[model samples]
Target chain A: MSNEVEETNSLKLVTPGHASSETEGRSVDAGPGDADCSPDGRVPYMMSQIQETLQTLDTAVDTILGKVEELHSKYEREGLAENPVLDACREITFACCFHDLCSQRLNIVLKSLEEFGDELTDGSNGTREEASILASVGESETRSATQDVQGGGSLLNGPAMTGEGLSQEDVDELLKSFEEFN
Target chain B: MAVDKNMPVLIVDDYSSMLRIIRNLLFELGFKNITEATDGREALKKLNRDAYGLIISDWNMEPMSGYDLLVAVRKDEQMKKTPFIMVTAESKVENVVAAREAGVDNYIIKPFNGATLKQKMKRVIGDF
Candidate 1:
């Protein structure tokens, strides 16, 4: 819709279908909007209007940049960088809003994995394991999206989780060791 | 009596990561047979399709919450005697009592350890 509006404005500056043809070096008799064309073939009024539209586009770009900056700052202030739930919720919201921007959603998914570090920082000591586990799982999509490593290197791959080599006793011992460390 | 390792365990939670973690933790505890559902409806479907010896569920989930799942399980002739445990982030004493009244064999609050999970499972399913 906005593209149609912009194209219409550009068309008003020249003959509608001839606009591209004119740019490609094909000359046509000046239309009503091109009356300011000089005898030598330069259209001063049309050139100035094009320049003005370019300036407007430049300003619009600047405004979008400013809005992105403002959003980033607000996100920082909200502590979304440190909260898994907030990060995941924001990622989903972004995906919904910018449905066409697959790269944006993918990046958000990867960045949200930092919640794993947040979990480690908060640590599991004396916290309700079920809640912590739930929170961790909620953020797991992010971690999975960013997983470049293979061979069971994920957080799931504890020492006892030796890429399917260890026995159940080894897993228990690993859990015990992790518990002791925590 | 010992838990039947061959019997499938049904883990119900709204979060996928928690399900994976729980499944892995159960695997570590020597229970290799496990299945998961994201909510009560899926859980009920899975329960109908398979015979699960034990169920671990989260209280807050859509379309047949853990509480609803427990009630449904108890009402089902085949699953009536199966052990049910509620794992939830809601830590209120009243909530625990309500779960107990709903026929939950055990309950665990969130942020629990693998040891706590194992102990709870042992209490419900008998020693491994």
Candidate 2:
């Protein structure tokens, strides 16, 4: 009976090995799980992801710009600048401006994200201080976002300026309005 | 009143791509003398510095919007006579009304082709 009791105690001690093995299995599944466990690592990883996306977008914009430039030069050299083909190309080129506009807006988003990430990883201060810092960051981000939307000091609003083409009625109205102004 | 194709035109937009696009379109239209500004402030500075025959500007910009630029241009004694075309994506009646009220010579919506631009230009500045 005493031998049996000793054997059960040995099994109980070995049971922790199973738990440790299970933990190891989980860790393996996580694959660099430390990043997931630590805010510092995770935030940076997220930032890198955003940077990679921005790089891809930048590459796409560059490619479009190159292709359009090539097309423009070809047309110019051929003296086909007045042709409908050139007209279509011009439209394509204008459409490509979307890339630059998107890039600017994305940069704003990236900046805000980075600031938030920094706040999340900042562990040097107490909770209260961190909260205050975060609040300030939030305020600044809000201001910038508002400025971006408002077009700041620029004369143009954002995408709102890119709405559908005006109608004949709209044109007539504009002309009539112009007459009133004059 | 025929538009002088030789007249110096100012193209304004915040995006370099937009500026380039507009510049190319203008080039195709036989407008040889062209000036470029990235924003309304720069456009205003250029307007003050040189006598632009026409101003084609995007409606949305930072620091100064196209509408604001038009207002400023209209208020200025020297620049008020300059034919101003507001290029925008806004088809809203209110916006058009506001632009007209601001004394814009013409308006062009986005995704417009060269022919459309030419027609608008002709309307504003007469046959170019």
- Best candidate (score: TM-score): 2
Candidate 2 residue lDDT tens string, B1-128: 66778989999987666677778778777898999988788999989999998999887676777877888899999989999998765556656767776778888766565676788888888886
Each model's TM-score, in the order given? Answer: 0.43, 0.64
Runs off by more than 4 Å, candidate 1: A1-182
Candidate 2 second chain TM: 0.95
Off by over 4 Å in 2: A1-59, A80-88, A100-157, A160-182, B90-94
Worst 10 residues of 2 chain A by lDDT: A1-10
Restricting to chain A, the TM-score for each candidate equals: 0.27, 0.53
Write the residue-wise lDDT of candidate 2 on A1-182 in tens digits. Answer: 11111122123222111222322222222211332436555556556656766777767766776787788789889987587866667667777766655665566667767776666656445574776677677756644221343343322233443444466456766677667776
Provide the lDDT at A65 for model 2: 67
Weakest 10 consecutive residues of candidate 1 chain B by summed lDDT: B89-98
